[model samples]
Target: MKNNPVNTDLPLFCPREGCVCYQSYDNKITKDGIYITKSDMVPRQMFYCHGGGHRFSETGYSELFGKHGSFKEYEQAAKLSTYGISANATADVLGRDVRTVEQWQKALGSKGQQLHYFLCLHIGINVLFLQMDELWSYFKNKSRQLWVFIALESETKFWVSFELGSRTICTACRLVKGLRRLGKWGDDHILKVTTDKSAAYKNALANIMGDIQYAYLQIVKRRVKRRLVTVKKFFVKGMAEDFSEKLRTPPLLRD
Candidate 1:
């Protein structure tokens, strides 16, 4: 198959901040020719930051450089791995070596983490109806209990934030505090929050109310004689809003 340019013909610039090499988007940057190779003869665009004489590549900080395959190949492996395929299997399917697949996977993961940090710190998400839940599992001969606290934005269905600790109020607070950076809260912007009837969620969210402003609700499920009973909607914090009417009882997956 024919190979394309590393950055898909996008204008390349030095990612370094305060570097004049970025230019004013009008000044022409000096093309320093290809800097590296991967699989075919993938040309890496090189530019010299005239101000600092700092040179950078079109694939600077890109996940495509270190791996044996091209950026497209890395993406293909990632797509197949999503379907429960292992690195080795994806490598075989892609006709690339297994180590190359592993490198691409790690590079993809690092890129995701970097993006998440940028969003969490620089870009705040204003979410309405953030669903909170925790799943329980035991590890090491069932001696250690592992609880994963998850906060999901119902409107956009984005996994807003998460924390890992025992099902304790302290851990819940840590997760809620992280939500403050995620985005603003209001019905006009952010609205109600949903969570199963967990005392920890109530206490933690209440404590953070003075800091992050938003309405909260709880979905309490009751079972009688091992039979499914009534699912009660209860107010956990703040005055209920109009969207509360839209809150529906979700099917119980498991305890």
Candidate 2:
């Protein structure tokens, strides 16, 4: 058996659940051997975790683990999905079965959720300006209405938080509360929030961030025949001068 060399750049951990050293950085992990799958014809490294008394592949604890198909195909499918392509359409384009595409979507979505939680959630971010809005969507039919509430940082264009549910106060509260948890405010920092004129948002902000020093702006748009005719801005909280100074010169444009 040819013993494969372990990559030092990547941390090795025992992925076995319930093991004492599970997910811990341990030196007991050693490269065991290499195996090539018939589908990809690529040599994959395997490792032995002496602490867990088990052997696993390098792809363990990752989306690629136990996947028999080419990584490129999976990536292409995910990219197509992000581009608003339906799974059935992606299957036809990739010459794959619809079920296979759906399975890949589920696996990729799970991995994406895990990554988002680790990278975004529970992390403190100093947000100077934020934009909050809800997009209308539906599931299967129009009768089943769904809303996607999203909060984004204006300067970095970073997606701060999101919630999916009905367009109601409960969903709005969840979104605002999530922002309150992730946001780190200083003594002089004043968060500026812009959103469409929605009563739910106003109430949710009052309930979640009442004590926090923040400026809230509501933009009410009047549409004639589905075309925007006019837009009116209203400051629901904080001084108008504060928002005027921040809006006039965004962080990116300032020295």
Candidate 3:
């Protein structure tokens, strides 16, 4: 791939932030498709220089650089589909073919699934609440089911995590693994993780976080009520307004 001309006066750096090359703090060039860090760790050229840690790219870089269009679009498309919008619907909004959308979705794979799940999980994690439930449904009579456990931060009303399962400990472990992979587990960042007194989550947290912190909330009506209320009051209602009309509504409201 042809690279855009590098700005020598400013100098380009590695793309990865935590990479040893960026940490070198020197004028490094791509040599033999490798970037030699200060410690002499040879990382690939692609990982070099994270657009200099500001905008992630300079003006005209989009047209002048990168292998493809923005990954942000793909992230948005995945979120839409995961949150109940069909892939075709996302394709329409993104101005891409349905198959292309599916291709992006596939390209994202587990990482994409984790990213979309973050929105769901973050909503529950920050709220100081726990709710567990087993939901059952059938698509063409083929039992499509889910076991969902949520850890909520009641104070901020944000999600800690949404651990989804196929009603098994193995899947629960997978959810925990996903959280760890996302760098959420075993971190002091989360204040309190709560879930319905499930041994699986409790055990998983214990294993990962070393008895860090948690609360066990019973499956109660008001917990869910509060969640629904938060969602409707914040996300749903906020998104429901027609921005075009709302921008025009202040004069009407005053009248």
- What's the TM-score of each model vs. the native? 0.70, 0.81, 0.43
Separately for all candidates shown, the number of backbone clashes (residues 3 or more apart, or on different chains) is: 3, 0, 25
lDDT of 2 at 73: 80
For model 1, residues 1-255, the per-residue Cα lDDT tens digits are: 023333324344456667665535544467777765646466767877655577777766566555667766767876877675888899888887788788888887777766776555555455767788887866555789988888887755577888888999988999988876666666365467788888888887778855555677788777877666988877766656644566666643466
Runs in model 3 deviating more than 4 A are 1-13, 16-79, 92-95, 106-142, 146-152, 157-164, 177-193, 197-199, 202-210, 222-255
lDDT of candidate 2 over 1-255, digit per residue (tens) = 023553336477788777888988864899999988765666778999888788888677776676656677888988998898999999999888898888888888888776665545433356788878888888879999899888888766678788999999999999999877765743478888888889999999889888888888887777687666776889898767767764732222111
lDDT per residue (tens digit) for residues 90-158 in model 3? 888988788877766666555545545645443222222222233443443566655554433343433
The Cα error of candidate 2 at residue 206, in Å, is 1.5
lDDT (C-alpha, whole model) for all candidates = 0.71, 0.77, 0.43
Ranking by TM-score: 2, 1, 3
- Provide the lowest-lDDT 10-residue window in model 2: 246-255
Flag clash pairs in model 1: 125-182, 125-183, 186-190
Better of 2 and 3 by lDDT: 2
Query: Which candidate should be chosen as best, given lDDT against the real structure?
Result: 2
For candidate 1, the 10 contiguous residues with the lowest summed lDDT are 1-10
